[model samples]
Target: MKAVKWFAPHDMRLVEVPKPAPKPHEALIRIESTGVCGSDMHYYTDGRIGKTIITEPLILGHEYAGIVESVGADANPALVGKRVAVEPGIPCLKCEHCLRGRYNVCTTLQFPGGPPYDGALAEYSAVHAAFCFPVPDAITAAEAAMIEPLAVALHTIELAHLMPGETVAILGLGPIGLLTAQVARLAGAGRILGTDLLGYRVDVAKRYGVDAAYNAQTIDSVETILRETNGRGVDLAIDCARSTLTPAIACRVARPAGRCILTGISGEEYGQFPVDIARRKELTITWCRRFRFNFQTAIDLVASGRIDVRSLITHSFPLEQSRDAFELVSRAGENVLKTSVDQ
Candidate 1:
């Protein structure tokens, strides 16, 4: 089998490697599509995201979809020949968190593309069979692969505990932020305001879900959002960008006693927040860890045509061109939105 392995920052090469066999509870998936994500860029450009450093050459993809070529002895035989979106994280079911149904934070969770465990930027991946959710024929492989990010967006909106017709401000109009905006609307948010350092993202977001957006590079995003809300700030603020400042900015953009969800991975160990602002406002702050039990909801949303995940897939690359794909995402070049590596 062939896989792209990251040797250093900005260095990913296609290398021949031994094909993996499915473990007793795993299924061997012939990877069809893998979405390049901003979190992946953290490792691709800097070889780490906060404390999860890449110490060895590792295959780097998690947002993926594939066909189940085979299943292990204990795995579901019914899954064979199914086209599915494979969830990357496999948690120890016996853990206290898993027993409580919060498996996203299971203490022994093994997330591929992180380190040590190999990922799906390859010809095949062996993920737990239970984690592979089959998509309907109407869903393309690229869109199925997009389910991972959409799941994150769903989890973000769910954390907001939003009331119908409440206002929302999404910081960092990248794929996740844009998806968050769409999910917020579906959840009945009144108005959506978004900000991004790149103008291209801001423009693309308006078409996706944002009612109003601004280029933070040229404008003061906090002031602008406050002004848009008539100096009251937004009712709910979600941070889904790579900028560390977004955590604090979200606090400032949110109204007093409102909620703020920190969903972005800024790739830093310690991030600074506005302590006084959050304290005075008595804001409710929640940090989103990947997702939990949201895949089925995401699949339903995309399959029902309620969410447009396909339009956000602006670029696609072959397995051999994985490096170029990463570079494009790193530079945010060519008005690129979400990119997928396909067979």
Candidate 2:
């Protein structure tokens, strides 16, 4: 097997390694496609995301999809030829969080491509069979890889508890942000507004059907959205930029008693908030972790053509070009939305 391994900041190498054999409850997957995620960029560029530092050589890809090459005795034999999206996090099902159906927050969760566990930036990966969601024939390998981020978008919208026809403001136009906006629209949100620091991203968002898209660097996003909304503010605001300022902007642009969800992970351990404004507005603020129980919904959305996950894929590279892919994603090159690595 060949794997793309990260050793230090900006250091990655494709090297040969022994193929992995699955345990009784796992499946050996021949990875077909992998999405270079924001978290992967964090580890590649900074060598860590918050406290999850890369202290040793690590494979860095989680948003991935592949075919089942083989399965352990306990795994279903029917999955051998199935195309599936790999769910990268394994949680302790015995935890209170897992018991409550909030397994994403399980205290003992083990996420691949983070620290200790190696990921699927290789020719093969062996994951628990239960974590693999079958991809419909209608979805491409790239779109299948995208189900991971789409799941995040789905979870964020679910947390927002958006009502039909309610206005939504998505503060970021990255892959997740763009997906969030589209998912909100599909989920019955009216007048979706999207913002990004990059003009190209804003343009892309507009093309993706956001009712309005703004280049935050050139305009006061909050002002523009509020002005358009008749100064009433949007019913829901979601921040996907991981910018220190965007959360406060989310708080400011949400109507009184409206909801705000922070779905991005900031580099800083803590961020400042507009306490006075948020308090006065009585906003219901919440944060989104990765995702839980949304993979099937994400797949169905894309497979059914209700969501266009493929349009967001702006770049693709072979496994050997993993480093270049990471660089493009980290720099946020012109018009780039999502970058995928084909194994």
Candidate 3:
């Protein structure tokens, strides 16, 4: 088998490796496609995201889809020969967080591609059968690889508690941000705005059905959005960029009694916030983590053509060229919304 391994920062290599056999209660999936995520780029370029450093060689993919080739003796035979979306995080079901339906925050969660565990950027991977969700025949493997990010988008909209006919502003036009914009529209948001520093991304957002897309570096985002909304501000603001000024900007551009959803991870421990503004406006703040139980919904949306995940997938590479794919994502190259490695 072949695998993409990140030995260290700026040091990923495609090496021949042994095929992994499924353990009891597990299934071995032959990976078809694996999406390169923002966190994957962060780990590739800097070797870490905040305190979670990659101190050892690790497989660098979690947004993946594949076909089940074999199942362990203890695994359900029904899972074999199914096309599935791989859920990368496995939590300790006994934890308080898990019990509360917040398993993404489980204290003992082991997330693939983050640190200690190997991930799905391989010809074949063995994962717990419970985490694998069968994909309908209507969705292609490339589309299924993106279900992970779409799941994040779905989770973000759920966190914001967006109401039908309400307006929304998504701050960032990256893969997750743009996907969130589309999901918000699907969720019945009346108006959707997406912002990014890149003009290409802004243009892409518009093509993806965003009502408006703004270049934050060239325009006063808050003012432009306010003017467009007749000075009432948006009813909801979702920050998909981990900018230091995003939270305050979100507050400034949102209406009183509006909601703000933060989906991106920041390098800094504490970001500056306009507490006074939030207090005066009575804004609701919501935080998002990796998706929880949203994959099936994402699959449903993709299968039904309600959410077009294909528009977000702009680049694909063979597993042997995985380094090039990572470089393109890390550098934010042109037309590269999401890069997937095909095994």
Model 1 poorest 10 in a row by lDDT: 200-209
Quote the lDDT for 156 in model 3: 97
- Assess each prediction's global lDDT (C-alpha) against the native: 0.94, 0.90, 0.88
CA RMSD for every model? Answer: 0.7, 1.1, 1.4
Model 1 clash pairs?
none
Q: Per-residue CA lDDT of candidate 3, range 189-250, in tens? A: 99898788878998878766689899998999999999989999999998888567887888
Error of 2 at 125 (Å): 0.7
Q: Which has the greatest lDDT?
A: 1
Give lDDT tens digits, candidate 1, residues 1-343.
9999999999999999999999999999999999999999999999998888999999999999999999999999999999999887999999899999999999789998988788889999998999999999999999999999999999998888988999999999988998999899999999999999998888888887799999999999999999999999999999999978999999999999989999999999999999999999999999999899999999999999999999999999999999999999999999999999999
Candidate 3 wrongly placed segments (more than 4 Å) = none
TM-score for each model:
0.99, 0.97, 0.96
Write the residue-wise lDDT of candidate 2 on 1-343 in tens digits: 9999998888899999889999999999999999988768778988877777889899999999999999999998889999999888999889889999999999888898888888889999999999999888878889999999999999999999999999999998899998998889888998998888998888778766689898899999989989989999999999999677889999989999999999987666668899999999999999999899999999888988888889889899999999999999888885688999997
Residue-level error in angstroms, candidate 2, position 245? 2.0
